[model samples]
Target: MVRYAFSKIGMTSTFTTNGSAQGVTVLKMQPARVLRHETLENGKVVVVVEYDTGHKNKLVRGWVVDNPAEYQVGSPLKAPSLNAGQKLKITGFSKGRGFQDAMTRHGFGGGPASHGSRFHRSPGSVGMRAEPGRVMKGKKMPGQDGNVQVTLRNVQVAYWSTEESVMAIVGGVPGARGGIVFV
Candidate 1:
């Protein structure tokens, strides 16, 4: 079973344990409000929740639950209990690097870097000679990079604090700091 929560990406720091350092990503969880409940045909209960209720823009999400009696409408939703060394899946949008070149975007090797070489960073020879004259579709050219939804699976939980409503996971996560992530 999986539980869902909306959290903001916090500062990334290194944690020391057993004389070794490991990078960890911190998340600040917001208290969610139970909006409604629905019973599916499969005999599972789905709870609709709203996060950041005090803000102008609120986020509403629905998660399946095993028991419907545990949740009450118009009440604060309980935070998911997480333990250290537990695996979690986190989904969020990656950081956006705008309008990058082919070399930076697609890892293309350009021509020689000598002063005389004209092709430094351009994506050379994009079309055919005669047959099917135009460049093929889905060409690796310059375009937008990142800012897309990314899911990281099996991310181990480093620590969790119920009083502070913060969680730290081992390794890096997608999206810029302060961005919202679903766990």
Candidate 2:
């Protein structure tokens, strides 16, 4: 089975998942935001992007979205280095929220605690004042967590199942399940 992308547009690339039972290839040209780039001591490059899949279907587990080999905001990136069955794993630490005295998001005080400590849910002091004068900018506060952009480059692709139109990447990728991960 073979998958064919019938049309081409300079703006966004959208291929259908028809006939071949393959997943569609959709390359969205979005505004390039602040991307994180880290260089390992060994001279490896890591790029991360907070990608978003516009689809409402949240049940799908895995999909590969590749970044162009050379990408500039308005410019389209070349197709990912690998195709179909191959995997690209991007790993990075999602920002962590600070210690939570309350169990709201973490399900802390929802149920009765075995311990009698009534002060079950609370957020420890954000940070000391005056001494630091400011609560450090990157300080972890109980707020929006995860959804960080992490790019793992040159990851090995297990296989590219053309019939399936999917790539299997090894190792764990960042973001929550069903997160839109760009290769």
Candidate 3:
């Protein structure tokens, strides 16, 4: 490995876990009051919230509520009512697939993959001809896929641990591991 004089490189420690699964984003309400906020790196506005009578401070990220003005210091945050064995809606960004085609993105059945029929995995005839003079607004074409806010309805809650501040749903959930999922 070659070392650069201008850049200081350090080692990052990672531990392998055998029991680790795709854990949901677990937020703990540790009595942290929202103080001030500043828009920092990666387009993330870090909220400088403090806890323990302003003795300790922490930054809150990946919160469902985006408006910083809604949070103020010296005011208690109203957490939503949560309980196990109840059906809840989970809204989160799905796994980002970047740019994709109709066959994978929109599930359009393409032409056969044999000889002269060269239209395999192609979105056939998106053009509306001269009738409307333009394609419809909600045409399912190749573009960005996933990473959009999708709501999973009727997801039954399997477990809810207030001590761990984590909730496990019955089935699959949206977004990648450790991605922000709002209940």
lDDT of every model, 2 decimals = 0.83, 0.39, 0.56
Candidate 2 lDDT for residue 177:
39
Tens digit of per-residue lDDT, candidate 3, span 1-183? 100000111112222245434333233333445556667666656555444322333334334236666676556454445676588776667789999998999888899889989899889987777898888989889999988888879876555566554455656667665444555
By TM-score, the best candidate is 1
Any runs in candidate 1 off by more than 4 Å, and if so which? 1-3, 12-17, 38-46, 53-55
Candidate 3 Cα RMSD (Å): 12.8
Candidate 3 residue-wise lDDT at 91: 68
lDDT of 1 at 65: 77
List, residue by residue over 1-183, the lDDT tens digit for candidate 2. 111111111122233345333222232222222244445576654443333234443211221224323333333222334554444444444444544434443454344456875544454455676797767786544555444566667565444444433544434444443334444
Instruction: For candidate 3, give the lDDT.
Output: 0.56
How many times do residue backbones clash in model 1? Answer: 0
* Ranked by TM-score, top first: 1, 3, 2
TM-score, per-candidate, Cα-based: 0.84, 0.36, 0.58
